[model samples]
Target: MSAERYEYVPHHLLRRRVRDIASGVEGELMAVINENVSDSPLREHWVELAHIRGASGREFTTAAANVVPA
Candidate 1:
C-alpha cells in the first residue's frame, strides 16, 4: 500500500489564538514544530499551545491541520 501524501505548506500560527477543530478547544498557539522526512517530499507540522481551556496541562501538541484561528 502506498503512503498518504501531504503538501508541505507551512502555516504562520505563532502567538495566534487558534481552536482545534476536532476537540473544539481554543488556546494561544505557542509553537510550530516541523519534521522533514528524508525519504519523502512532505513535512509534518505539530503545534503547541498555552492557556488551553478545559485542559489538564499547560501545553499540548496537536496536528497543525487540526487548528484554525479562533
Candidate 2:
C-alpha cells in the first residue's frame, strides 16, 4: 500500500488562491461555490473570502486541481 499525499492548506488560503487565479477578470475562470458539491459553511466561507479579495467570481471545483497554480 502507498501512503496518501496530503498538503495542509487552510480554507482561507484556498480562497486567496482562487482570487489570485481569477485576477479580477470576469469569465469562466472566476471562482464559484457550487452548493451541490459543497457544504453550506464551506461554500459560504469561500464565497465570502473570494469577494473580499476582489474575486467574487471565479471558477469552482470540488478538488484542488481546479484551483489555479500560484
Candidate 3:
C-alpha cells in the first residue's frame, strides 16, 4: 500500500519507557515484529503505536475500513 500512514502495531509491555535505547531519533519511535511467543523489552512499554497522519485528524483506517485488515 501507499505506506501505512497510520497503523496500530501490538506491543507486549515494558517496565519503563524505552525512547532512549531503541533506534530512531529522540522523539521518534520504532516497532519490532515478534513471530514467536517471546516478548521484547520495547513491547512492555508500548501497547500500540497510534500512527497519526497529517493535521487533518483523518486516520488511515476509518470506522468502516477498519472492519478487516488489509
Candidate 4:
C-alpha cells in the first residue's frame, strides 16, 4: 500500500530525529502535567495548538486520558 500513497493515514516508522524531538516535547508536557509546573517548549506549542484548534490543553489532556487506542 505504500508503493505510492494511500488516502488514509499510514503506519510507518518515524525518523529517529523526529521521534526524539516528539519524545522530548512529550516529556516536558508530561512533566508539567505531573508536577503542575515546569518550563517547557511544549507550553509554547500547546498555546499554538490552542490558538489554532480553539481548545485548551486541559481539554486535550482530558480527551487523551479517555482515549481507547487502536
Quick one: best lDDT, which candidate?
Answer: 1
Residue 58: error of model 1 in Å?
0.7
Q: Model 2 over residues 2-69: C-alpha lDDT tens digits?
A: 13222234443443433234343322223333223234433332222222233344343334333443
lDDT of 4 by residue, 1-70 (tens): 1222112222222111111232122211221121222245344222111101112333222222222211
Q: How close is candidate 4 to the true structure, as a TM-score?
A: 0.14
Candidate 3 lDDT, 1-70, residue by residue in tens:
2222334445432222223222221221223222222255333322233222223433321122112111
Candidate 3, clashing residue pairs? 13-43, 13-44, 13-45, 14-44, 14-45
- In model 1, which regions exceed 4 Å deviation? 1-10, 35-57
Lowest-sum lDDT 10-residue window in model 2? 44-53
lDDT of 1 by residue, 6-57 (tens): 3343357667778878788878776655533345445444333233333443
Residue 2 of model 1, lDDT score: 29
| Candidate 2 structure lDDT | 0.33
| TM-score, every prediction | 0.52, 0.19, 0.20, 0.14
- Candidate 3: what lDDT? 0.27
Candidate 1 TM-score, C-alpha based? 0.52
What ranking of all candidate models by lDDT puts the best one first?
1, 2, 3, 4
Badly placed stretches (over 4 Å) of model 3 are 1-4, 14-19, 22-70
lDDT score for candidate 4 against the true structure: 0.20
Q: Considering TM-score, where higher is better, how would the candidates rank from best to worst?
A: 1, 3, 2, 4
